[model samples]
Target: MKKYVRGLAIVGVLTLAVAACGSKPAENTAGGDANKDFKACMVSDSGGFDDKSFNQTSYEGFQAAVKAKGLTPVKAESKSDNDYPTNMTAMVAAKCNVIVAVGFKLEDATDKAAKANPSIKFAIVDSAPATPIENVKPLSFNTAQASFQAGYLAAGMSKSGKVGTFGGLKIPPVTIFMDGFAEGVRYYNKQKSKNVQVLGWDDAKQAGLFAGGFEDKAKGQNTAQNLITQGADIIFPVAGPSGLGGLQAAKASNGKVNAIWVDTDGCVSAAEYCSVLISSVKKGMDVAVQDAITSVVDNKFDNKQFIGTLENGGTSLAPFHEFDSKVPAELKTELDTIKADLIAGKITLESKAQPKAS
Candidate 1:
């Protein structure tokens, strides 16, 4: 009878252990599960993933999403615009649950891929989805606001009382930054009752703007030099890889000139010219990517546009870095005030499409 009781007790203990194991949460699994195997993929624009600007920012966001959601991620770097469709299609074929296509250059390809793969979720950065497919989400940034702060800084710091702005292309996103920079300078001049002038891309005409046609460092360098010759001591280069030219120009100018970087933190990325970089207009791609991944993991992914603005912490000015000591405390306080006013709608930074110049 004692022996029989011992056998029954051992069976009861084994049954309890099995029941507890079976009741464990899905998230606590040792190797994860089928649902956790969801794959996210990103395809870069012609600039590739290491342009150190928009492309790099978007790629970081995608990576953030992947890591947060415990998702497997695949990346396809396009060498040119022609490769967008092929790369996007390859990701779909690889069973990617979500596809992120970076840049306006990939708009057409993204549209086509999203249409062909109705079941796959799509996120297009820097461009809106044409058809508003059920699974498509468009992400855009209010870069103008951040650029405005940069303009304010440039205007205040300018020894020549003149600032210059340029971009790789005259696209909406690029021009928006230029417009904000110009307007910010104008705003500063109006507020301080100064006469600081801004050149390149007339906010009204949106024309007469210099476009190096993307990624030609030489053209960017030439443009910066011309602006400097015209008495511009501060330059804002919104161009991609081409913006490096402006940095180079600033360096060669013997510390008489300075510049503002775009997208990523130029202080770290452009160490050679860190001394000349007042600050960078940063877009919070990392946070956005992480949020998207979390949404996917929670099965709450939605098809809508995500806007990164100052209010949302999606975009802002990078640290002053080496220039911190040079920036006046009053100027910093004034900048903060301006930022709050802009967010509160007390001050408006115009974002209307600039009229074409005759």
Candidate 2:
């Protein structure tokens, strides 16, 4: 048996990435309202609007709605957890038509504000708190499905026979991607009878490397370097902005390593890192946010949960851009077959980290 040298980067190794909820309000108004001042406001997580991941995509969708429906746009950018409630309350005090919270960090704040301001429609990205307030809708995804494919691709392409994954935090939203990634590597090992190793995470134990927060690029870079030093040639970062650091690590490796991105295609979202990105496990937050705005425009805002799964085109593996020729034809065919199997219910992934089907 090949010896497994395990080293876990757990929480608290660096600054505690707790979501402390008030900060200055950053607002955006994209032209005056053409829809009778149908105001739409959004509150970003600590990742800010330029995180180049979830927050960016969510805001982009909101911006798209502002242009498409001629709606008044309002936005508040949070620098920390403190800013979440502060931003939401300000938007509520303004009595905006709809307020979107950009991440799971804002779920608690969003819940309190939504209940207090029942007249306002609320949307939360990446979190569905157990208590369902009629006014707040959750925009979530089973991103694990897509991540599994990325893991398989990494395993198939790795000459080192070692791939790695890590997250900004240990939260379910981030861990779901890691869980699927590790499992996919295991599945690939089984199918190919190869000794491919996933360095960062252990699915059964639900323990692995975490940078403790998403905002620190240095931490992400170090985490990727750690995995690479341990023989990982492919790194999948489930962190938002921190993922950019991992991309930097990979790019600096001079062909020594490649990376898989999360939330949105790094090829486009973080185009600077495309050369190092193998692919991305994308969640359709842009599409979901746009749909939410459309629903409001149609005056049919319900608190129903919007679950993004592969079957719904809400989550998917991106095209193997620079790696198109590098991936074996057989491997690509296998991925398609696996995708079909997953959608057809012939295969099921077991993960407590996925969104609860309510």
TM-score against native, each model: 0.86, 0.91
lDDT of 2 at 23: 33
Question: Which residue pairs clash in candidate 1?
Answer: none
Candidate 1 residue 358 C-alpha distance from true site, Å = 31
Could you say which candidate leads in lDDT? 2
lDDT, candidate 1, 230-289, per-residue tens: 999998988877888988999899999999998889987677889999999997766776
Error of 2 at 245 (Å): 0.9
lDDT of all predictions? 0.72, 0.79
Candidate 1 lowest-lDDT run of ten = 1-10
After superposing candidate 1 on the true structure, give the runs of residues whose Cα lies further than 4 Å from its correct spot.
Answer: 1-36, 353-358
lDDT of 2 by residue, 163-243 (tens): 998899888888889988987888899999998999989989999999888899999999989999999999999888887
Query: How high a TM-score does candidate 2 get?
Result: 0.91
Q: Candidate 2, residue 260: CA error in Å?
A: 0.7
Clashes of each: 0, 6
